[model samples]
Target chain A: MIEVENLTKTYGSYNALKGINFRVEKGEILGFLGPNGAGKTTTMRILTCFFPATSGKATVAGYDVFENSLEVKKRIGYLPENVPLYKDMEITDYLTFVGRIKGVSAKDIKTKVSKVMGDCGITHMAGKLIGELSKGYRQRVGLAQALINDPEVLILDEPTIGLDPKQIIEIRQLIKNLAGRHTVILSTHILPEVSMTCQRVVIINEGRVIAVDTPHNLTNQIQKAARIFFKIEGPAVNVVKELNKVKGVKMIEKKETSNGVTDYIVELEKGNENRKVLPELIIKNGWGLHEMRSVEMSLEDIFIKLVTEEKGVKT
Target chain B: MRNFYLIFKKELKSYFYSPIAYAVMTIFLIITGYFFYNIFATFSTLSFQAQMNPTLAKQYNLLNISESVVRPLFGNVSVIMLLLMPLLTMRLFSEEKRSGTIELLLTYPVRDIEVVLGKFAACLAIFSIMLVFTLLYPFLIKIYGQPELGPIITGYIGLFFMGAAFIAFGIFASTLTENQVVAAVLSFGVLLFFWMAGYSISFVSSSLVSVLSYIALTQHLESFAKGVIDSGDIIYYLNFTMLCIFLSLRALESKKWRG
Candidate 1:
């Protein structure tokens, strides 16, 4: 539903997006993960035709964002990071106005708005002024507005930034339910949000795509060759040698023994699940293995690792 | 056209929902009302004295409605329009930008001209509403004396063109910044420049004086207020207002790149 190629955007001397490429297939929920100032909003703005890219091409809903911006806009729903809304308007009125501009037919606006309002859990605040609504309700209203015309693609920037934990879960659940129905591309720094709702994650940093894979596959990759910290009761000098001899071991760093139990942090090559052989190896070397536990690398740590690497970003 | 229509409707509603429209309207009516009463008082006194002293009325053209009331009233009213038009148009694009709704508005399938024209039409609609209140003066004058239909109609036509020209410039000013006050001040400065352009003719060379008088916003209306509907005045006002609107479209288009 969306394709971006060499999308470069520069504001004067500072480059916001540096020739990055990514795509979101039809009915796929792609999580765009990046730290602040990672050009996430810049990318979304280009797709929505809010602004033009300096050099490159982008298409949404099979229409070129630059050449056929109107057609692309008609098929895509955009919820900006700030959720730009008219403060004085009532929720229903605001949604109606959005519907009108979104090109929703008059005969369908009432039914479509009411349905989206219900889906976003904002039906109760239909009569309330948007300015009077709390932040969470305002977010839901923003989501409802983006759901106008049953858009084929929904681009949400930081959709749940200000929501409380419970509201976050509710929004995540709603987004999760939309996976098969709409192609969603949401950019957020929250890792768990991607794990919770996004089917495929594209991690961007410094205006480049550093990682792209399924969350499950990423976690599997992290688990398969995770570093293991070992506290063994043995002489420190020989322990490093024996540990490095293990067929799958990539590197081993040893520290002085505390209470005579030598510590070793080992990073094994990827797909090395031969942790079962570690205890046997220590026994064969006459070393008493006091502790043998693999260090758990969470999704956040993986993201930080990929982003900090200067080149050879995993994708 | 449909895009323009929707945006125009929303903007029109926005004017009524906010206090700015009412505030400008009330002040406009009060200012116009003061002048209306002043003109009516002068008209009544002049005619009353004319009835009493026929020789005095014959000696002076003071008893004529076109000179005593019609000319001065529109001349002053156009000044009021120039001053107040910024208030109506300053928020047209600036508020949308300040509130960050400009992104939403521009990203919609609507074209740039639609947004510009929609806002221009909305401001024109609001100014027209305020201008309508001044019509009561003409109606009242008709009740007492025989107000010449030609000059009365042409005076209003002049006010419309002047108000429209000011509105176009005001909308252009609004597009230049997100600060409503800055927009208003910028509009005030531009309109004031045109208002004084004709006055600068005496100080400048003769070659430039003709150009200055031609560009002066109030100068073209002089023919209309005098009951002379010259094609020059029509073309000047039409082209000037259209140029301002065109400039506004260009400004809006540039935002897509500059942003």
Candidate 2:
């Protein structure tokens, strides 16, 4: 539903977006993951036709963002960062105004506005002025305004930035529910929001797309050595020495505890099954293994490693 | 057209709901009303002989009000408009740009011209309402005395065009800055220069005076105040208004491309 090719935006001396290239298939929820000032908002604004790119081409729903901006604009719904709203207007009134601007029929505006209000769960506050709403409610109202025209593509920038935990979960669930119907391209610094709501993730940093893959694949790609953690009720020195003696154990780190319990983290080379061998080795050594678990790498770890590591993949 | 109407309606509704519109209207009425009542009382104290024999009137009527008092008072109406119209229009695009709502507006299916025209129409409508309220001054003069209805009508026509020109200039100024105060002050300064330039023309030679007078908006308004519907003066005001609006549109487009 969206195609961007060598998209670059420069503001005087600074390049906000550096030749970004990506595509989103119809009905795919693509999460734009990046740290702050990672060109996420710039890319979103370019795609939505709010601004033109300095160099490069982008099209949405088969319409060029520059040449056919009106068509692209009609097809995409954008919720900008901070959810700019007229504070003096009521929630319903604001939605109606947005609907009218989006070219919704007068008769249909009422139904569509109410439907979006229900979808975002802000129906109860329809009569409340936007200034009087809580941050969570205001974000929901912004979402409702974006969704009122039932756009084909939804471009949301930090949709849940200021919301509380429960509100975040609610918004994540709401975005997830939009998966198959709306082609969503959301940019956020929150990694879990992407993992929960998006099927594919595009990791951008310093104005470049660093990695694009499924969250699981991203995690697996970064995870080289399989590590396992153990809390054993035994002598710490003996446990570390025996773990090092295990055939496939490449590295081990032991922790000293006053309770006579030893904690060790053991790393085994890839393609090695540490779980199947760990119990037999513990039995042979007469060491009591109180608890054992594989320490799998999470998306957070991969994200931090990818963003922090300087000389890695250029793509 | 439909999009323009929609934007226009929303903008107009915003004016009614916001305190700026009401505050400007109230302040405009109070100040203009005071000046109007004071001028009328002063006019009432004078007799027709005061105009024929100024030397005799200088003895009895210590305050010598001129036949020019009516025109200058009406001209002061333009000054009042210059101050208030900027306040009315300062939020036209500046507020939207500052709040990031301009992004939402631009991403809509509407063309850029629609947004500009919609905002222009809304500001003009509010200005028309304020002008309508000022009509009470003309009507009071008509009821209390037999003031020439022709010049009064033409004077109002001059005020209308002057207000339109100021509104367009104000909108253009508002487009330049996000802060309403800066927008208002800039527009006021621009309008004041044009207003005072007409009077300052006397200090220069007649040849250069005509050039400066042409640049002065009030000089064009003088023909309208004389009950003469000169197409040249009308076109001048229309062209000035259009130039400001065109500049405003260009500024908005530049913002989208450069900012």
Candidate 3:
């Protein structure tokens, strides 16, 4: 539903999007994950035809964003980072205004506005002015605004920002519900937001595309340094030495020793399990294996490592 | 055209949604009405003094409706509009930019010209509404005096177009900045400059005289105020309004280029 090619946007000497390329298929929700100032909003703006790309091309719903911007604009619903709304307008009035501009037929505007308002669960606040609603309600109204015309593509930038955790989950669910009908491309710096809500993600940083893959695969790839927390009743030095003897055990660092019990953090080599070997080795040495728990590789870790690491992956 | 209408309706509704439209209308009407009553009061006081003194009766008797009432009313309203139109038009684009709604607007499927026209049309409508209230003065005159409707009609047409011309400039000024105050001041300064330039027609040499008169907006209004209904004056306003509207459109388009 969206294609961006060599999408370079330069502001004088600085590049906001440096020849970045990505695509989203029909009915797929592609999470655009990056840290702040990472060109995610710039990419979304270009796709929505806010401005033409400086040196490249972008297409949405099969029309070039620059050449057929009006058509492209008609097919995509954009929720900007600020979720710009008229504070003075009542919800129904604002939605009606947006509906007409989005090209909903005159007779159908009422029904369409109500439908999106219902979908976003803002039916109760239809009579309130937008300024009177809370952040969460206003955010829902913003979502409803984007969904009013039922466009084929939704370009949402930081949709859940500034909302409470429950509101976040509600918005996530709302977006998840949008997937098999509208192709969704949303930008966020939150990793869990991507893992929980998106089918695929394009990770960008510092104006360049770093990685693009399924959330599952991206997390799995960075789980190579699987870590474990170990507690054994033994001398701390001896526990370290014994764990080193087991193949696939990469490193062990002593954490603490309370009385005779020692706490150690162990790193396991990729694709290998010394988990089975550790219990047998402890029994032979007669040291009690008090507690052993493998640490789950979290998407947070993957995101931090992926963003902090300096390796630039090509396409 | 439908897009223009939709945008125009929203803009027009928005003006009333806040204190802008009402505040501007009230202030404009109060100030212009003061001048209207003041002009007629002077005319009546002169007539009264002339009847009592008999020495000044000839001069006061010549205080006709066209000279003492219609001409000064239009001139006063013109100056009043020059000041008040900026207050109404300043927020047209500046408020959108400050609130960040311009992004949503530009991303909509409407063309740049449509947005410009929509905003200009709405501001013009509000100005016309304000002018409509001032017509009560003429209505009262029609009841009490035998005033020529031709000059009254033509004078109002001139007033409407000139106010509209100011509105076009105001919209262009709005496109220049995000602060409504700055936009208002900038538009006010520009209009004031044109007023000063027109007033300077008396002080300059003959060679520079024609140039200043042409540059002066009031020179274009005099014929319309006298019921001449010159097409040249009509075309001047049309060209001025269109030129400013076109420039404002270019200013909006420049953002894409500047980006």
Point to the candidate with the largest TM-score: 3
User: Per-residue error at B18 for model 2, in Å?
Assistant: 1.7
Candidates 1 and 3 compared by TM-score, better number:
3
lDDT tens string, model 1, A34-63? 888988999999999998999999988779
Global lDDT of each candidate: 0.86, 0.84, 0.88
Candidate 3 residues B82-141, lDDT tens each? 888899889889989999999998888889999999988988888888878888999988
Worst 10 residues of 3 chain A by lDDT: A306-315
lDDT of 3 at B177: 97
Question: Compared with the true structure, what per-residue lDDT tens digits does model 1 show for residues B180-221?
Answer: 999999999989998989988889998998999999888888
For A141-219, candidate 3 gives per-residue lDDT tens digits of 9889889999999989999988999879888998999999999999987877888999999988889888899988997
**Candidate 2 pairs with clashing backbones:** none
Kindly indicate the candidate among 1 and 3 with the higher lDDT. Answer: 3
> Candidate 2 at residue B101, lDDT?
84
Question: lDDT (0-100) at residue A7 of candidate 2?
Answer: 94
Off by over 4 Å in 1: A223-300, A311-315, B49-55
Checking candidate 3 for backbone clashes, the offending pairs are: none
Error of 1 at A188 (Å): 0.7
Best by DockQ: 3
Candidate 2 per-residue C-alpha lDDT over A66-119 given as tens digits, one digit per residue, 9 for 90 to 100: 999988999988999989999888888899999988889998989999899988
Fnat: each model in turn: 0.62, 0.81, 0.75
